[model samples]
Target: MPTHHIVSAFDEELKYLANRIAAMGGHAERMVDQAVFALVNSDHGLARQVVANDEFLDIGQREIDEKAIVIIARRQPMADDLREIIGAIRISGDLERVGDLGKNIAKRVVAVTEARQPVRLFRGIESLAELALTQLKDVLDTYASRSIDRIGFVRDRDDQIDAMYTSLFRELLTYMMEDPRNITACTHLLFCAKNIERIGDHATNIAETVYYIVTGAQMPAERPKEDKSHKVTAQATAAADPS
Candidate 1:
């Protein structure tokens, strides 16, 4: 099929937008990592730095959004070009939200540190965050390649992130119930867990955008029931474990 010049130009713009969004995703992921690092190590300076870097992420998101708008207005793209432009706009919005969520987590880190209190951030939350980051990267790769297979891969990983969230939440609830003194700290930790959960959701949203761009069909939320069952079982196990 011969490529139309308009499609070609739109492709260039969309590619630029994709690259920009991926850059934003990368930065947001780093921000989350730094925030957690700050929490685990009580590094208030690093938490502040993460919060500061979020401003740059905002600028990056705005630039991508403006470019997407320009492409839509000037190019008058249709079909796939249209999908690509719209997807860029939506994905960038999600990425911006991810940055905001990271900032929120960083703010919590500062509060926890200033109180001279320690929150036991276990392997479960760390594992979940890492899983979400992997899914974010996979979504970016699939967006760049427009590969349906890669999109599927991201979907599968999203399930894993969800499971991690379920386990983390259950464990935190146990801590709160065990000690009244743990209430305030556990609440903050819950918010942090929710922030990480939102990041996973945004990554899933980006994957859906890629799917729509490639197929022009909205991907249905099809999380497996088996996964949910397994997550429930694990939560029960965590509740029962005395260690």
Candidate 2:
């Protein structure tokens, strides 16, 4: 076999892997979008559809896994080539988890819809999901572009998603505390919000994967994270208020 022909085959295989990952990324992002829309709108059917679409991501991950294993065995890829293929698998795992998180939120739509809560709370969740989804798209774009230039920015925005989720957490707790009737719905919303936050985390994971594939170096020891929901308490919030 001609050396150039072998190199061409290798390049084509890598391209196929990247294209598949990009397709999965878009599908996962859409699932989250539709899931959040359904939750906010109380659209049970769309929520169900989002749940159903999760299987596509699952299948995509499996296909990528098989294709990557074949490529590794056939090509005996090393160094940078190995990293690219391995990175795709890692990103696929993250994307699959993101899809699972979206499905989890979708499953709660019925429960959240049953418990009456303020419209503003749902709006807050929608806003947070939007931010996370945008960042997810950005990180996926970085992966497809094969550029590390935008990865740092995408990674930094994960903090903003955390802060937004934390803010929504406090607001939901305040509503639940103010009215016992709101607890059921607010609790479900809290879970949904956490899922969105986790999606942001997955986006960051993809960004890190992109950085590693491009630069062959791990990100710094500590990445910015601002989620404070676990530490928050109504009593502390009230005590800290000077107004």
**What would you estimate as the lDDT of candidate 1?**
0.75
User: How accurate locally is residue 20 in candidate 2, as Cα lDDT from 0 to 100?
Assistant: 90
Give the per-residue lDDT digits (tens) of candidate 2, residues 1-243: 012335787888888899899899999999999999999989999999999999999999999999999999998988788888999999999999999999999999999998655689799999999999999989988887776776667756888898898899889888988888888898888889989999999999988888888879997657876887777778845522111
* Clash counts for the predictions, in order: 0, 0
Runs of candidate 1 exceeding 4 Å displacement: 1-12, 114-120, 220-243
- Candidate 1, residues 20-139, lDDT tens digits: the string is 877887898788888877776778889889999999788987898789888878988888878877888888888889889888888887665555554455456667778877887777
Question: Mind sharing the TM-score for model 1?
Answer: 0.83
Clashing pairs in 1: none
Please give the distance, in angstroms, between residue 131's alpha carbon in candidate 2 and its true position after superposition.
1.0
